[model samples]
Target: MSARRILQLGNPLLRAVSTPSSDSGECERILTDLRDTLHEFQRTRGFGRGISAVQIGEPKRLLYLEFRGRPYTLVNPEWDWRSEETFRLWDDCFSFPDLLVYVERSCAVRVRYQDLCGASHVLEAENDLSELLQHEMDHLDGILTIDRAIDRNSFCTREEWLRQGHPATRPEAFASKT
Candidate 1:
């Protein structure tokens, strides 16, 4: 239940695709670590909603998230459907906490995944949760938010992003075809 060290952006482990976890015991341990690490990040860094096992150097297809007070554990999650519509937003990650990448994501998504007990479930998410899940799922596939940046100017340091008064407020700056 200890908070594990989250691998940083340049770590090769972060670039490797995570393998699916078949053991319930192993999945439980990873889930606990992800939850603990997510909470630790929020406590010290002020914000974090989700984390992937790869972010902790486990290279397992597991992610844990806490959104709007509810906790979620996604094992071997895969996209079942995505909306044709998309939206632009400033995306951040636990692997690169100091950077903000402006990216586009599906406005809605449906994902099928397994629980810790090996029970399958479907999660349909929209808006913020949709983006958050997409972001974490990308980690399972060795993709980072920076790789999904809308353009070269899509990157900003945390300080610069805050100075700009939040990218959501300046929609014109992120204007690009979705």
Candidate 2:
């Protein structure tokens, strides 16, 4: 498997809504590629939470996420529930290469998705995990954390992002799947 080239911020694919897989067969291939892509991202970037197929030029509703310690593979994922509390956090995107956007997201969430084995799994995540799921799922919806920022000018380059302090706020509500 090859390390798929991550689509940068200006790529139209990052702005377009992804289509769901045509069938389970297609989803299986997406899962494998996504897993490979995730491995590649981890190896090259040293960190990542999840990725959507669209971010790699595949306009399918597929995502692979690792929440803190638990790795989850989601196919045709969707948000089934969300929490009332919201928190703000600094978020970065692989597609954007290296830019930081402070955005608000749910503090807790409930999601439903299909695993590689074709079984369904319901996951509940909070804090960083919840933030991650919301972020990847936004890819499917043609949305990015950058869109949520009230001050777009606050966006920072990778170098500045690293030097910046930790996220100082959180969104009031959070829910996500995938």
Top TM-score model: 1
lDDT of 1 by residue, 102-159 (tens): 8899999999999988999999999999999999999999999999988877888999
For each candidate, give its TM-score against the true structure.
0.95, 0.86
Candidate 2 residues lying further than 4 Å off, grouped into runs, are 165-178
lDDT per residue as tens, model 2, 2-103: 568888888887888888774887777776777788888888889887889888888888998776676677888889998989977678888876777767
lDDT for model 1, please. 0.91
CA-lDDT, candidates in order: 0.91, 0.79
Candidate 2: residue 43 lDDT (0-100): 87
Single out the weakest 10-residue window by summed lDDT for candidate 1: 169-178
lDDT for predicted candidate 2 compared with the true structure: 0.79
**Which one is best on lDDT?**
1
